[model samples]
Target: MPRSNWVSRVVGWDRPRREQPAWLHGDRQHLLPTHSHTDRHVVSTIPAAQVTKVALKLRHLVESAVPCDLDESEITRAHSSIITPEVVQAAKEAGGSEYRACVVFCLLICKAWFRQQSVVELWDADLHRGREVACEVIAKKLIETEDDTSFLLHNILLQRYSILVDGEPTYPANAIERAVDLHAVDVITSSGYQKCVDHLWRGWLVQDEDNPTTFVDYANRDKISFFTHLDPDRIRVPRYQNATQLLVTIAFLVLFTVAVNTPNPSGRLDVAEVLLYLFTLGFICNEVTKVYKAGYRILGFWNAVNGVLYTLITASFVLRMVGLGQPLDHGHEDPAHHREFYRTLSYNFLAFSAPLFWCRLLLYLDTFRFFGAMLVVLKVMMKESLIFFALLAVVIVGFLQAFIGLDIVDDMAVDEYGVIIKAMANAVMQSPEFDTFGRFSPPFGTLLYYFFTFIVMVILLNVLIALYNSAYEDIYQNADAEFLALFAHKTLQFVRAPDENVYIPPFNLVEIVLIALFGWWMPAGRFEQLNDAVMSCCYAPVMVAAAAYESNVARAIHRNRARGGSGDDYDDVVDHEWERVACAPETQVDFEAEGWDKVCEAAKSDIEVEPAVQEVRQLRAEVEELKRMLAEISRAVGAAAAGEESK
Candidate 1:
């Protein structure tokens, strides 16, 4: 059967269908002469069947060459598709057979042109406009594709077409052009006949006058509708998901209250205080930036505001340094001003390091730095912002309280005030390092200073770090569980036959809320009930899964080692770390060197790690606690029953 007959049969020739006979004449490498433009004058004298076969083969070359089934799902599931005729024609001409190849082509093309302004123009127009505009504009650009086309044209044509030679060819003028466009010029290597490429030199192929542009457009409907939903596939997220996200964001934002404060002494703003303010403004800007669609329009003002705050704080630091006669250069750095200048420089540099890149000339680079730096700032501000601000406020309000109680600085000296300010500053940097020492050292401080610092940095930090670390870990850990659920959903699709219209996967609201309700947390109890039952249920499965994964990895490594394969394929350090991470027992790892000799004698490197070292950290704690409780219970029971028997 001829290739044209197949399409004719599939589309069902409305008037009448007929079978057309055809035969494969030549391969891609071989050349068989056909006919010229003048030869076509006598084409009718040749077999009518041969002409039909050629037309059919050409149609197949156009349709089956470019596959586009790659993103059929995207079209079916997008927030109302905005398909243009260019997209439609490309897909149709490409046909379903070449879907994956076309997708790869589109990806390659987008990768190449993403930074080009013209691509943005094309995308915006294609994504937003009516089909009518796209067809005309796309046709013009389609011509330009001759110059900047995706590699698909070459790859596809190479798969389908053959070079012709030997006899007089009766090829269509357009077909010759198509051959040349596909670089079939390799067919002609003879001397001085690149010009005899005559009848084959057609430059354009006409598009089907009637073609599908916007395959289906529902760009105007609300995404998810609980009442009269037409298509769930078109909606990206679930109906109530927006509400869940909004509430969650609000809860997170409310934690910012921890950072608020009163004021500085002299009722004036100070450098650290202003820096904290700029940090807050930047955070709010970051939250607004989290919005995907409206980030630019709605958050633009906040971005500007954040930029101003940074500039002002930087300027204030410079002005203050100038007022104190600190060195702007070597001229002002004499002994009289050297200490002040160094202190001022250190303070300003630490505070403003993230903002120096904010100039419009380097805005993109600044934006990249800003987001990461802001996240760190958010963490710092969430816990200490309140304390910091409160201290600031106390600086203002505390003086008033003391004044009302008849305290006066007028009679006292400047050093007294300096001592008070210095005390507050010293109280800010304490940490776990301080836990080792009962008292302060030379560079450390007095009992009072360390005590206040301990309250602010050490003790409060233990309390807050315990809280934040627990929350962050819980959320981070649950992310894997969500991925597991998605994996399960996909696996289920393969296991069971499903209706195409049915959604195989359920909505994925980050299960942080449900996990919260279950009381499986960092400290394991603050938010919900103090029930270890719930905690065990939540954590046990993850632990079991982790154990299984570690066992498999250990097996793979041992197998690789036994085969005498290149261990170079694996990073020994990374593998060691992974074992420390993935298979490391919940028990604390033993850093103690007591078992070094015994470990060296072990056959497998993995087995060399003392299991006790890992398990002992956790199990020891529990077992010890259990033993104590059981002893106490035994005593209580013995005492109670004895008293009863004696009575």
Candidate 2:
């Protein structure tokens, strides 16, 4: 067998052949009874081809009725007429699968709209509106179904497939990628999607209420909530988790500051120092676990910052320990200097890392919309700057080599390499040192230096500026989409590694001990029970506060519903007016009126050319008919001649 086939068999992609059983032998098989399976327990699945066909028909209907120039009202009407509640319900009923056919239908329609937007010269607002309506309908359905529709929203919709287009496989992209590409932030950030994510996060660590002994897949014992009775409802929110992490980080920073600044004449460990040591150990453990869980993803920019921060702190602590262990008096002339040297080095390392600690606060602060959006812009800019830096590096290396070659005449007197590097760097900073280069190689050196300055200052600098501006403009133009994408990405990060539980730093230190003692040998039920008891005690205050807030919100919603009012009352007239201004008629073009004639002219031309092509085909058919008649005549004449000759 081929290696590929063998590997496939090993992985069970190609099922291995099974030997026939004795019971299935001719006589035995006839005597044995057979059982029939019922459809009642089996889920009905709609074929992918049928779903795609229905989606295409729906797409054609929307496209034909609502052109790019159609008004919002007309577009809404067209979408509403096609994607009616009846149609959605029928699709849902047809598929008894966990990933309902209706969701797949909506996703396909959205994907079609996205593809159109990418291919067209001008984006159709009406098409966009149609997509938005479809998304709204999807959101409504998802919310109504709640956890039941989770498989489609969280798994199937997000699964990438290599779809063939025009007989070749195209790049794989999931629903999230399509939405991001189309700048349809409304879909990913929809209340429905958020609720789905929350459901997934909450279920990350859950217990079986009825059967405690039954093991729950994807359950994390570390994330066991204080109130497991409430299960998902009272599970810790990601935002709350971030907030708690921020508090812990702040506490860690404060402890470090106090520990370093406090005097220790006797070289004995103080309370602050011990507490700081514990915090550092917890942070180190947390980072290690994150790296272990996240793998290569922990190599991102922020994680690099964290790695550096922790490295410095760990080294500083080590140096401090060594310094404390040194004897106060020695046989040397300056006895105290030896110990002071180590202490000074340790303090230097700790002080040097203060800026990084402050910078790390931004990581947690990103939960806020303003900070999150700004971080997205910053991340884009950093990625864009890589291009600039790569080009600059090549330019600098080329110039350095040229300068070195020119300085071969006077090798001993001057450090040509250092001079050239400083000159190039200064030129990049808009400050040129032309005089130093002029004395070394005379005219050629001066000329080269001038060229370098112009290239660095005028050309490369402007290119970098242009790149930054382009990135900034692109992000700001679709600011909402960019922010929502960032938000969704952040939200997914929490639940991506389902096995890694939520043990915020210092608490993780405690979790480490418990895992070692009980995690290995204990039964799943007993282990979960242990985690629940520990979490309830450790997070009593937080759980109580969260429960109270939830109760208040629930009561408010119920009261509003009873009074016939919308649950939310935080709407502002200013926001409403702003939305109106944004979508006003004056701000938009009436493409239907302006471009209708052009469309008609193009259609007429196509119509004219189509008939001419038809005529050519018709003439070809006539010629073929004439040839056939001639062949028949020739055959008949040949037959007659043959008969005459025989007579």
Global Cα RMSD, each model: 34.6, 17.2
Expressed as tens digits, the lDDT of each residue in 453-473 for candidate 1 is 556675655666666665456
* Runs with alpha carbons beyond 4 Å of true place in candidate 2: 1-186, 189-191, 194-235, 263-274, 329-337, 407-409, 416-423, 435-439, 499-501, 564-647
- The CA lDDT of each predicted structure is 0.33, 0.57
lDDT of 2 at 226: 33
State the displacement of the C-alpha of residue 64, model 2, in Å, after optimal TM-score superposition: 11
TM-score of 2: 0.60
lDDT of 2 by residue, 611-643 (tens): 668789889999999999999999999999999
Q: After aligning candidate 1 to the native by TM-score, how far in Å is the CA of 50 from where it should be?
A: 65
